[model samples]
Target: MIRVAVFNFKMLPTRAFDRFSLQIAISGMSNQTDDEEVHVGPDGTFRPTPQQAEDLQLQLDEVEQELHQAAKYGLYLVEKNEELWQTIERLHVEHETAQTEWKGEMKTVERHLYAAQQERDAWRLCVIPLSLRIPLSSRKCHAVEDEVFQLQQSLTAAAAAQITMQMHRRGSELRRSPSSDFVGSRSVILQSPPSLDIDLDVLKQAVDDKDAQLRQALAREVDKDAYIKRLQQTKRDTLDIIQQMKTAAAMDVDVRRSMEARHAALVDRLSAVQMKLDESQDALQTRLEEESRLRDRIEDLQAELRSQGDDVDAQTSAIQSMRHKCARLEKELQAVSELAEAASTSATATDAFDRLESFFNLTALGIILEHQHRIAQEQLLEGSSRQTIARWFREAVASEVPYHAWHAWLTQRITGKPRRRFFAKGADVSPSSSLAKAIADFFDKYRHDKKSPKRSLESANPTPPYS
Candidate 1:
């Protein structure tokens, strides 16, 4: 709420006036409506609300809180009676003054709006040439029509020229009519202008030259016949020389001389070889006794093998009769094999990943360790492939690594057919380092250290279930 500091308290209704006080009391005791409601009239003047009333819809509770806050700053001045009449008249005068001032501002805005509208109209007019296209279609049609008319004119001109030419040709043809008497025509042709007389000296010379050429032609034929015989003689001499050279080259004695030393050496070696062969026969005779004894043992073994074969046959028969049982067993074995293989593969992949991790870590550790290898030392410091210390990855290959079977398995995994050339592929991957290390580790772990081991691959125990 706002009020003038030097309020005209003299204009206020009498404070002690019991009649007005009673009226305020009566309203306060009764309905006791808002002061604005009670004082509102054409002649009344009221103070503004303490808070600036914003247009936003806030909760009543927040509005009240705001109002309470606003009330703390100042209180509204209340009044009644003719004093409000004078204030109301003054407010009306002020409102008129504000309206007049606003009208002036609105006129300025209107001036700007009118200018802007004019500018917009000018811009639209300027853009008319762009958006409001005068279609090329009508102009194009006119141009095409003109072109066609011009072409027709050209055609007419060309036809006229042709007809004129034809008329001239027809007139000439009529003048050149060949329907004349023969003697008269001959006489006219002979008596024509001197221009018709062509020179005959060149023709007379040409006839004499032809007669001379006929004589020369006879002489040339005789010369050609003689030359052909001489050419045949020369050709025969050339062929004779070529044949003699070929015969001499075929009987070349140099090749025999080249083999002479080798043939002598062969003769000497043959005698020595014969003596050695005699000694070899003697040794073979002694070995034959040993072989005979071995043959007896082999016979006994063959007998045993035959017995075993019979047993095996019986077993085979039994297995054949129990076809379903064998099939089930085989399937179970196959399933077990597949499961084992899958597990092995998973374990291998895991182990490989683990090894790779460990390998990198160990590599890092080794970098921290003393430097012995050149590559490793370089790789450690550099971090970059050029700078980073690296040894062959195979250096840390485990002794327990399996090579052959794993190679076979890997081959099976990579290619549907089992490739025995994995060693070659491995060689290609890292021949000097990883390949050697892997091969070493695989051999040490999977193969028996003995010279020989009598165990089939399938019979061997499975790898443990760990990476």
Candidate 2:
């Protein structure tokens, strides 16, 4: 039975179970010493007495059962650890896939937005009211009007010249040929007839033809006057239409301005929504970092288990800690999902964001203030005179420097970024009102204190006085 137990113990795969079996054998042997002595065989081979053998066999059976149980438990832990690793890997892969999908979705959305913007611009151009598109220059209409006026003047002049010429010719013909009454009177006065003879009928026929010519000239003048009046009326109508178009164009300008304002508002809202999405992405990144930390912790636990498999309590505690971490991770994941959903739905979901922002703001403010305090202490420790330190702090508090200038100055001091040759200034460059206010409050608290002392003095410490 002893040989069989030894063989079974040796055949066990794990060192942990082997150690456990050795511990069991040592305890059983110790119990035998308290109970009775083992009998030795004559051939120099040791043999246990009957009671010792039975006790030894029973102990071996117990040890084997324990070894088997330990092996099974170890296998279970290994499998669990593997499952955890697989879960972590799966989660990591899912995170990467989600990020890729989100990026693709964002790109697609941006493309669609760009296309929509272009389409909107195209529609704005294409669907513009005619009033807005009305030609500003009336050169063509002016040229037509000028040509019509010139043509009317030329026709009127021609008609007048023809009438004048006809009148002149009639007057000359009447003068050359005397009237019938005048001829008769002249013949009576002369007693004898003159050598030249004048026919009265022929003179009357010439007078009638002249009268018909004058009538035709008057008709042509009347026709020209009527045509001129019609052209003038047409010109007046065109002028009225142009005036109405100009008024409509002015109204269209106002409408276009309003539409542009609305478009600008929409663009601002879109930018706000994009900012929200960026915040959610930041949250996701934080979750990934947490997951990485958890993975590292699990790997540490696994190493611990390999090195000290006997420490079951430590393993249980590590597993419990992992469970707690996993729960936390789950909660974080849920929060990230909520953030993303809110960001997608509305830009107005600022209440929750404001709370988060406030928390981070306070944390950052505390860090900055602490850093500045440490720097001040170091300066004092470096033997800077108390008056000089006080003067520097006073000067900083009194200066009217803008937040952006302060930010740039700090950035240069901390990161060694180079400045431009000429300082670029803008009104809307910086709006970290919270940080600025925090800084201002910090300064205001101790600015009035004139007692200059060393860094060792608690009261002289240049620290944030806020709770």
Candidate 3:
């Protein structure tokens, strides 16, 4: 209740007359007795006694002090309210400035995003057409796409570098002429024109250099062709030697000596080729190292450009567009290089495979010849007759050794046939021969007699089992 009364009192208007009236009323109430009687004056009108007048004066003084304090408080509150309004206005202005800056940044970001999307769509269009036109395997297609992505990265990095360099140069120029007219700066840019012309000249120069390099590479490829022809000749010679060795496996002269000599010559040629290949590899490594150094420098420039500010984004994008075209050309060049490398690798692999096949043929021929030679030696040691040997070889050839009973049949033929003999009875016979014949005849007659008795006994008691 007290708080409500205080609030209501604070709500009252701060007027001097109202404060005086309130003071008068308070003085009257304080002077009044419990019966509500009042002092009377001589003229019969109401008047204040000395105590009442003193009390009223004191109340008026207190009211005046309170009014003065309220007036100071109101003045302070007014100043504070004005300060708050000023603060509100300042905050509103800051918010608007911030919003404007944010909007500008968002617009810039949106433009960049839109441009990136467009570039992505353009790349897809290019790749889709290329992929559709070519009849490449999936692996090759993926490789092509990877190469494109790498080229894009390289081009973007190069563009970024070019933009960064240009921006630095522009900043320096601007700094040099802080008070130069805008028209004057524009005139200067038109006069020098550092961007496209310079890039074109550089590209042309690079193309000329690449043309020279390609010519050199072509010369190297010609040398490789010569080497490949030599290898082919060697292979043909080796095959011929193998055929000769097969035909004359049992010849008196040794064929391995000629083969060994040819193998040594092939090894020498291969060693030379290997040396050449190593030299080429070393050159490639050096070139790649140089390229890596250049790439590193480009990255450093890009990093510096990134540090400069956000203002170069549009210029960077324009540079990238130009570089994308350049990168397409680079892609074709890289494809050519890759094709050449692949051809070289395939040729090498083919050569190796051919050499390996030839070696295997030679090895198999040697094994067969050695086995035949060992068999001949064993037969000679066993003192096999010439006729027997001839028969064994004839039978081995006739058997054809396939489909059935090769081992058993060959073994039976290799063991000589059993011998049969006949004697002439009219010719004069030696005494010993006659005596042996008589003894043989007597034994034969005795054996016949013994068999007759046994036959009679069997006939008389024909076995019960037989019956």
lDDT of each: 0.42, 0.49, 0.48
Backbone clash total, candidate 1? 7
Candidate 3 least-lDDT 10 residues: 458-467
On lDDT, the candidate that comes out on top is 2
* Residues 370-424 of candidate 1: C-alpha lDDT, one tens digit per residue: 1112224333233322112122223223333333344333233223335445355
Q: What lDDT score is found at residue 164 in candidate 1?
A: 69
Q: Report lDDT (Cα) of residue 432, candidate 2.
A: 25
Backbone clash numbers for all candidates listed: 7, 0, 0
**What overall lDDT, based on C-alpha atoms, would model 2 receive against the true structure?**
0.49
Evaluate model 2: give its TM-score: 0.24
Across 22-132, the per-residue lDDT of candidate 3 in tens digits comes to: 444444464344755456768765545566556656855686698789989999999999999999999999999999999999999999999999988855654443333
C-alpha RMSD between model 3 and the true structure: 51.5
- Model 3 local distance difference test score: 0.48
Error of 3 at 344 (Å): 76
Best by TM-score: 2
lDDT-best of 1 and 3: 3
TM-scores of the candidates in the order shown: 0.14, 0.24, 0.23
Which ranges in model 2 have alpha carbons more than 4 Å from their true place? 1-210, 240-269, 290-467
